[model samples]
Target: MNVLWIFAHPEPRSLGGSLRDEGLSALRAQGADVRESDLYAMKWKAVVDADDFGRAASPDRLVVGATSKCAFETGELGEDIRAEHEKLAWADTVIIQFPLWWYGMPAILKGWFDRVFVKGFAYGVQRPDGRTARYGEGALAGKRAMVVLTAGAPEATIGPRGVNGDIGDLLFPLQHGTLWYAGMSVLPPLTICGADRVSPGQFEAAAAALRERLRTLAIQDPIPFRHQNGGDYDDDLVLRAELAPGRDGIGVHLDT
Candidate 1:
């Protein structure tokens, strides 16, 4: 299996980095070809610019495909973005590894998504019916994605009555909206809590668990998300603009 691991911790010695290493090692050992995007090491750009859309001399004719000349012309973007896109196309499973910061992904990783997931690539795709493709169908339809997040809060503290609603809620946008919407089957995330005070033993356990999880990627069924444009909601838009609905015995519904 080809796997793309996008890591987003500033410190390579941090707990997040260690977990990422462990996960990568395990995936490699399992015979899965792995490619990593180290945001900090790459000094990745956090802002999107006009050049993201290939430049067209004629203002009215600006198109979305990656032009060969644009790749050499766009200073900020290099072969790396194309390499990432190729990795995404090649991989069957993708793992997003990062430390939870301010209830969301780090700016670097978010920017990676914003830039790498481009128009004519990630979104704005078409279907065989000549209709706009929905969440469950696209260029990335058969792929699977899972988040391996580390947080400073304890698991209990992130529960229904705790400071955070639930770990699942915190990741709905990434798991459902981004992955599922991009036509990937997202698996339940494997989150490690109490990151600040985790013991060596706990860390080791977490690594082992992650390895086992990666080994079972093919057999593990993905979280069944409701397809947004499947005519289930009004006007073919997300029921809650930024929230995913929850079904009984499925997962948490942040809006509820």
Candidate 2:
């Protein structure tokens, strides 16, 4: 299996880096081909400008997603984005590894997604239904993805009633909005907590767990999220969650 691991940590000698190395080694030992996108080491560009489209010379082409017809005319990128896209195209599975910064991904990693997942290629794909294609059912469908992250906070502090009020809620945008919307089957994430003061033994355990998880990637069951166009929902179909569980206006009963 081909796996693309996108790592985004400033320090290569940090705990995140060590986990990355251990994960890579385990995947390789299992005979899986792996590719890495080390953002900091690559000096990735953190901003997205018209120059990214190779048409910056034309002032009129400075619009985002305006490159609907703009092909990759120029074979130039700052090496990082180029390698990332190539890996994305080649991999069947993707593992995004990073330290949670400000309750989200590092700026560099977010920028990577913004620039790499472009229109016409990543999204804007069309189907025969005349509907805007991709997201729920598009080119990126059928692939698998997971986030293996390290956090400085203790696990108890991010529980449903903790200071953060559920880590899952914090990750909804990334796991559901981004990955699921893009048609990738996202597996449950593996989050290692208390990285700020984790002992070496604890770190080793986390690394081992990650390695074992990667080994079973092909058989992992994906998170089942309601499809936006699953027919039971509508434009105004607010999740009947608050009013009454499993109740829908269209007589469709959802599993609460």
Candidate 3:
């Protein structure tokens, strides 16, 4: 299995960093070919600008979507963006490692997605029959993605009935909107809660859990996110009322 790990923690010696190291080692031991984008260490530029497309705005206004599409299709994008695309293409699995900040990933990682997952590549794709190819079909149809996150809150707090809300619900935007929307099957995330208070035993447990998750990367069944074009959704991409009858929110869309 080929895996690409995108790490976004600012400190390499921190808990998140240590777990990332352990995870990568475990993947190596499993004989999986792994590549990584250590965002902070790379001094990754987190902003999306006109430079990414190598084009000057004709009316002095940066046309981001259009520029990205043109640059991606014409091979005119800067080296960094293109390199990331190449890595995604080469890997069958993508693992994102980061600390949860304000119930979301850090700014740099969010910026990475904004810049890397551009149009014509990550989105704006189509099937040969002219159907919109996403939420289950697209350029990344055969690939899979998983999130490995650390949260400072206690596990209990993040449970379905906890004050912080269910972990699965909290992560819906990333899995359903971003990863699955790109056509990659989304896997259940590995979350380490109470990151700020982990004891030595907890660290060991976390590492062991991470290793097991890695070893089963190829065989584990992905989260069953409802496909956009699947019969569950109507032609307008809305969920069929009969299916979730009076249900709403993120949980209602799960096929399980």
Candidate 4:
């Protein structure tokens, strides 16, 4: 399997960093072709602006979605963004590793998605019926994605009834709104909690868990999110009344 591992931690000696190293080693050992995008090591830019569109951008005003769509179609996106796109296209599996900050991914990682996953390439795709292709269909369809997250809070705090909220809900915006929307099947995330405190034994356990997860990357079942065009919703894009009736919020979107 061809894999792309996107690492977004600032410190190489950090827990997230060590886990990234372990994960990559595991992938390589499994005979998988892997590529790495160490964002901090690369000094990745974390903002989007007119420069991203080049000649495709409008001088009068800048509409991100529209301009990005035009730039993507015209092949005028920035070199950095285009390079990431190339990696995404070549890989069958993608692993995004980072420390959870303010209950979400790091700013640099978010910026990576903002720039690399442009309108035409990731979101603005359409089917023959003129409907938008997303939530299981798009340019990146058929690919698999997983998140390797680290949190300073204890595992219980990130659990179902924890104060920090369930990890599943905390990550819905990414695992569902972005990755799944872009057509990649998303595997259940590997979240290493209590990131601020870990002993040698704990590190070994975490490493083993990561290694095992990678070992089954190809056969692992992705989170069962409802597909947009999979007859689970109505014409207006609302979930049909019969399905998950009386239930709402992020969990309702899951195809349980």
Model 3, runs deviating above 4 Å = 53-74
Query: Highest TM-score, which number?
Result: 4
TM-score of each: 0.83, 0.83, 0.91, 0.93
**What is the per-residue lDDT of model 3 for residues 1-256, given as tens digits with 9 covering 90 to 100?**
9999999999999999999999999999989999999999998899888676343223233222322322235255668887898999889999999899998989999889888887667776655567767788766778989999999999999999999999998888888889998889998999999999999999999999999999898889999999888889887888899987888889878997
The RMSD (Cα, Å) of candidate 2 is 5.0
Q: Quote model 4's TM-score.
A: 0.93
Candidate closer to the true structure by lDDT (higher is better), 2 or 4: 4
Give the per-residue lDDT of model 4 (tens digit) for 110-170: 9998878877677776676778888998877899999999999999999989999999999
Worst 10 residues of 1 by lDDT: 65-74
Taking the tens digit of each residue's C-alpha lDDT, what string does model 1 give over 86-112?
778788889999889999999999999
Distance from true location, Cα of 161 in model 4, Å: 1.0
RMSD to the hidden true structure, all candidates = 5.2, 5.0, 3.9, 3.7
- Give the alpha carbon lDDT tens digit for every residue of 1-256 in model 2: 9999989999989999999999999999999999888889878887788777553233343332322322332245445565666787789999999998999999999988887766544555555565554445655777899999899999998887789657777777787777776678888889999989989799889998998899899998877666655653455645544434545432222223
TM-score of 3: 0.91
- lDDT (C-alpha) at residue 119 in model 2: 55
Local accuracy by lDDT, each model: 0.75, 0.74, 0.85, 0.87
Candidate 1: give the clashing pairs: none
lDDT for residue 101 in candidate 4, whole number 0-100: 99
